[model samples]
Target: MRNVVLAHALARDLNVSAAVIAAFADAPNFHTAHRVRSSGSELLPGPGKPLITPLSYQSIIAMTQSLSRQASDWGDLAAWVNRKIEHVLLKPRHKLRNHI
Candidate 1:
């Protein structure tokens, strides 16, 4: 499932758990929510910032499963994911390359 794959990615990168992922997935936008704000992560969405949210669990599941089924190019997938998380997980250019 797409959510499962995403959950794994989030858990690995953000150091969270299944419950946390589920809670986040259940949110309206997965960012513009009180719980996400309280999460204290740089990934938090704020005014003027918006994030794509899956329309349904089934959709996410179908998406991720499709990726796997299609044997999607891992390099391309990694590039896409990097674009999404680098800003929130990695350090700024001036901070030196000591990844977070």
Candidate 2:
């Protein structure tokens, strides 16, 4: 949705390919900081032909939930929460990976 909205806005402002806009729309998960930082990419213009930025969809939800609760807080259910949250957070990505 973020990607879609950005692509729509960029397409409205810039006369570029829909695919290019679509690609930019998915930068968080499709790219890495190393790739974006190693050098400028398709996001740059003028002589940069293959303007591509990688997306790396960092997961904050699980991390936040984990940090919100501590070992003492979990008491006897730490293991259960760990397994359950891990599964919930990873399920979509796992499916995506499998599908891909």
Candidate 3:
């Protein structure tokens, strides 16, 4: 496994025991383990954390597909402009409300 190879290389390079190298590799996990403090606050995830949102991912894919299918003609451009104007005008109140 990659961990074993890395531990071996680190052990050789740093002139430390394999157990020490393995401990070093696991230091982050050890520090970040989920345990409540006396003050009742939890530590937030740091670097190398991945979060997934399925609906957001699907919405982006759909938007890309829809935009790619729009025609390059002048009429299509005008319609697109009108739609943008309507969205900007009609949705300003809702957008500002959401932000506030």
Model 1 CA lDDT for position 17: 47
Q: Please, what is the whole-model Cα lDDT of each candidate in the order they appear?
A: 0.44, 0.43, 0.37
- The 10-residue segment with the lowest total lDDT in model 1: 18-27
Error of 2 at 2 (Å): 23
Model 1 lDDT per residue over 57-92, tens place? 334444665678554554455455445444544445
Top lDDT prediction, candidate number: 1
Candidate order (TM-score)? 1, 3, 2
TM-score of each: 0.23, 0.21, 0.21
Off by over 4 Å in 2: 1-16, 20-32, 43-51, 59-100
Q: Tell me how candidate 3 scores on lDDT.
A: 0.37
Q: Record all residue pairs in model 1 with backbone atoms less than 3 Å apart, i.e. clashing.
A: 2-61
Off by over 4 Å in 3: 1-72, 94-100
In candidate 2, residue 40 scores what lDDT?
43
lDDT of 1: 0.44
Number of colliding residue pairs in each model: 1, 14, 0
